[model samples]
Target: MAQPLEPAERRPANHGPKVAARNRDALIVAAREIYATHGLDAPLSAIARRAGVGQGVLYRHFPDRTAVAIAVLEENVRQVEQAAAAEDAAFADVLGVLTWHLTESAAFLGLLHANGATGHTEALAHALVLSGRVESALRRLLPEGHRLSAPDGLMLAVAMVSGAVGGPTREVREHRAVAAWRLLGVEVGPVRPFEG
Candidate 1:
């Protein structure tokens, strides 16, 4: 997507920083809700409408839809980081976090998927980072490098949990990841969502 950075001068000079911040925040929020519900194909004008702003205002704030999608994905990353930090959770829970993100992070998914044909490099990066978090957790959960390569096992786990939904559902992928961890010799308990 074409990115247009805001002219640094347009900010602060207008709302003295605080209101500018509010406006930017509002745009991101509006974009998030829209992206979540409608996927990434919702128009900038629609987001502007949701935010009670003009199209020009939306463009002024976000530059383009990819920028908005990036912001949403970034927030998702931040949330995943926070979830990983939760002391109450098990190491295996990172898969849970990742699964939740994949299932629920629709705006990030939709927008990126919509741009799939052109090889949306940015959205692809976002997905990789999100998936990497799970991979890291799986790495720690497993013993050595052995379990990490269990792609077939992972696919089986997906087929079972999601009925082979053919898309990433958190439970399935995370189960597969943990199974790889097991293949690595970690011995994770049976992933509950697939307890059959």
Candidate 2:
């Protein structure tokens, strides 16, 4: 699958920052392009052209660069949360999602951590809720001790994998992920028998 365009920052000479919902999709696409090209330093004019809108329209939907960036970050988080709802998710499935996120979003992750949101980081906040629900469901599916431990264990496992590696490619990432899973007391793959 092709990678989605990342969101960029834009601050033209306006303050309208609230376009119609119809224009939001286009603006978001353009913002991703601008951000991909220039990181946080992308210009509003470029994004406007990409979205086929004016400076007023850009600001209409996004008051400032930070707001635009945050919106994009939220969108990305929404995508991640969606993936977390798979019916066939396994222990490795959890690692796969975390692995994908770490590499694809190291930069945005830092930005999000630094920017405090009272209740506006809806994507992540939604994630907290989703996680609780998923854990509740899985608690019935896992082993005894593994039951109560899942909620926190799953979250911590992701953190461990993320911390151990700085988002390596899938092949390398899977290896680290499997190792972390073992460290968390969940063994994956067939064990090699040895004669002592």
Candidate 3:
């Protein structure tokens, strides 16, 4: 028979702040990988194991699966916020970056969308706040005298980008970005692929 693992061997090293921080970051990274591959329904224990942390550490960082999902969405929102606030950022660039992040986060987004209608009020509220932040950023980046409202334009862009998430080609993504711009009444030139 195989030897049973020791308690210390099964859990992450509890060295200090550095170790704690590392464990936290690892959890997020592992959560992203697991969710991307196995989807939102993947077990929390799988996430802890993937992070090389025990269930205790995972619970200390995120009390529940919803908390973990929210943290991931928050990180995604932060990246878009930073890009949107750039001094020389163009609408196409913002759209491209948002699309890239959304594509990578499609599973999480799907979970939030499903939760929104199934009585997960906290998650739904967080999703709305994040969406509002993106919409506000888009409004700030819009050229003067734009026709579509920011919310309307953002919805169209989000829908288009979400649909293109599984696309295999850069051309497809760029094409969707261009279409999004057109929906907002802007005739943007060719869109460059997002570096992130």
- Give per-model TM-scores: 0.54, 0.48, 0.72
Winning model by TM-score: 3
Clashing pairs in 3: none
Considering every candidate listed, which one attains the maximal lDDT? 3
Candidate 1, residues 1-196: lDDT per residue as tens digits? Answer: 9989778976545444456666676777788767656667777877778876668766776777778777667655566566555665454554455444444554454333444564467776775665455454444443344443465544244223322212344445445455544444434443432111
Q: State the weakest 10-residue window (summed lDDT) of model 3.
A: 187-196
Worst 10 residues of 2 by lDDT: 187-196
Ranking by lDDT: 3, 1, 2
C-alpha root-mean-square deviation, candidate 1: 10.2
On a 0 to 1 TM-score scale, where does candidate 2 land against the true structure?
0.48
Q: 45, model 3: CA deviation in Å? A: 2.0
| Per-model lDDT | 0.55, 0.54, 0.70
* Candidate that beats the other on lDDT, 1 or 3, i.e. the better one: 3
How would you order the candidates by TM-score, starting with the best? 3, 1, 2
Clashing pairs in 2: 8-35, 17-59, 17-60, 18-60, 18-61, 19-60, 19-61
The deviation in Å at residue 106 for candidate 1 is 2.3
Write one digit per residue (lDDT tens) for candidate 3, span 1-196.
9987788767866586668888987898788768776777789999999999899999999998888888877877777778778787786677667766665565665655565665456766898888888788877887775654554755665665565454434445456655655655555433432334
Relative to the true structure, candidate 3 reaches a TM of 0.72
Show model 1 residue runs off by greater than 4 Å: 1-16, 52-57, 92-96, 110-119, 137-196
